[model samples]
Target: MKRAGQQGWSTTEYLAILTGLVVLWRSSQLVLEHLAEHHDEFSWALMIPF
Candidate 1:
């Protein structure tokens, strides 16, 4: 079996990615809540994927 560091992601790298994801999730939730509070003034457009 390959060690974590040897396989490319060390423990620190995993922790960093996890932390970043958590931050992003929290920020997105805040933004959505703000938009919901001011739905009349804020609108979100969905982008269509080709």
Candidate 2:
């Protein structure tokens, strides 16, 4: 019984980690798309000589 409970807890932890990773991945993609769409403005910022 104790082993089964531990297994359930482990599964839940893994699922949570996987869900977090998926959310991060999707958000990163959205950010990239936005950057691409606004590349002209972004490029101008990059051109500023340090």
Candidate 3:
């Protein structure tokens, strides 16, 4: 069987990608929260992710 890391991706590369995704998710959540607070009407849809 082929190993998962055999494609040349190292630990550091994986960590960096994970960190970037976390940052992106947090930033988006903050923006959504702000909008939900100030724009009250559409707040419910924000949590739906669509």
Instruction: Sort every candidate by lDDT, greatest first.
Output: 2, 3, 1
Pairs with steric clashes in candidate 2:
none
Taking every candidate in turn, the Cα RMSD to the unseen true structure, in Å, is 5.9, 1.7, 7.1
TM-scores of the models, in the given order? Answer: 0.64, 0.87, 0.59
Q: Give me the overall lDDT of model 1.
A: 0.81
lDDT of 2 by residue, 1-50 (tens): 47988999999999999999999999999999999999988898888999
User: What's model 3's TM-score?
Assistant: 0.59
Q: Across residues 1-50, which tens digit of lDDT does each residue of candidate 1 receive?
A: 88866657676788899999999999999999998898866444434444
lDDT of 2: 0.95
Point out where model 3 deviates above 4 Å.
Answer: 1-9, 40-50
User: For model 2, where is the 10-residue window of minimal lDDT?
Assistant: 1-10
User: What does candidate 3's lDDT look like per residue over 1-50, in tens digits?
Assistant: 65777645676688899999999999999998888688877766778965
The most accurate candidate by lDDT is 2
Better of 1 and 2 by TM-score: 2
Off by over 4 Å in 2: none
